[model samples]
Target: MPVSGTTKNTAYTIVASSLLAVCLAYIGWTWLMSSGNPVLTDVVLKLPLGENGFIYGVKDDRGGATVPFSYRYYVYRELTSNEQIASELKTAGPFLVTRDPAIKVDIQGSTINVSTNQEVYEYHSSTLFRHTNSNHYTPVTINLCKHSSDQPTK
Candidate 1:
């Protein structure tokens, strides 16, 4: 009554497969329960963000830009009007601009107002005063306008 090598190999394979399945199930269950939201899963896992190797550079064809392709770029932003862009550029040193309209933190200061179109200008507090956190990053609020989505409190 000797055990065959084929039988031993089959048993090993079965055990390995079962262990792998259990490990995968545990990981999946943990992720689903902790976040309770699949959308946040990508964020938690630090998924690959296809940001072009280089970002933030001024383009000549600027007409108030925003993210062109990827909406996954995670950063605070504000849109500047043509007039505001001109005025700010005078004082704002070497800052980069994507095709999509954007303002940098260095140039963006407190009490900013921009009007991209022929509409009334929107006043903004372009300072990182209120959203200031005593953490690794010093969150600066570039107030494109008081109407901005998350305008940092000044």
Candidate 2:
């Protein structure tokens, strides 16, 4: 015997409703799990340089000794302006100055990696302007700190 049109429609509706309910439950579970977890913010620095370029005096939040607050730092190469470079350099302070023999930077491809005595930081290159025809080098420094409210010392 063949199934009736009404019966087929009812079966289809049941399947669709069950799928929708499952999707809603999954979404709710994901939200609940994420809400309880801590969220971390990242700070990035971009430095533009040609092959064999060098950067010095790179430090981590822990006075260049250890990584702090689980923050991941990066330094890469990208297009930048003179004013912006100057501002970042000033903000980064004399540590970024190459005068320190302890601090040394080596450019590998379009990225430069900065490392402390204990940890090494990986740098990322800009996908949008990685291959630009400019020969200028710009150092971008990013600092990641815990929110004042979240910090226990504060």
Model 1, span 35-67: residue lDDT tens: 321121111011111221111223232222562
* Pairs clashing within candidate 1: 57-96, 57-97, 58-96, 58-97, 65-100, 65-101, 66-100, 66-101, 126-143, 128-141
Give the C-alpha miss distance for residue 39 in model 2, angstroms.
6.5
Q: For model 1, what is the alpha-carbon lDDT of residue 56?
A: 22
lDDT of 2: 0.39
Report how far residue 55 has shifted in candidate 1, in Å.
Answer: 24
Write one digit per residue (lDDT tens) for candidate 2, span 16-117.
999999999999998986533212222233344554222323322332345243233223233255344333433332322111223234455544443333
Clashing pairs for predicted structure model 2, backbone only: 47-76
Q: Residue 45 error for model 1, in Å?
A: 29
Model 2: what TM-score? 0.29
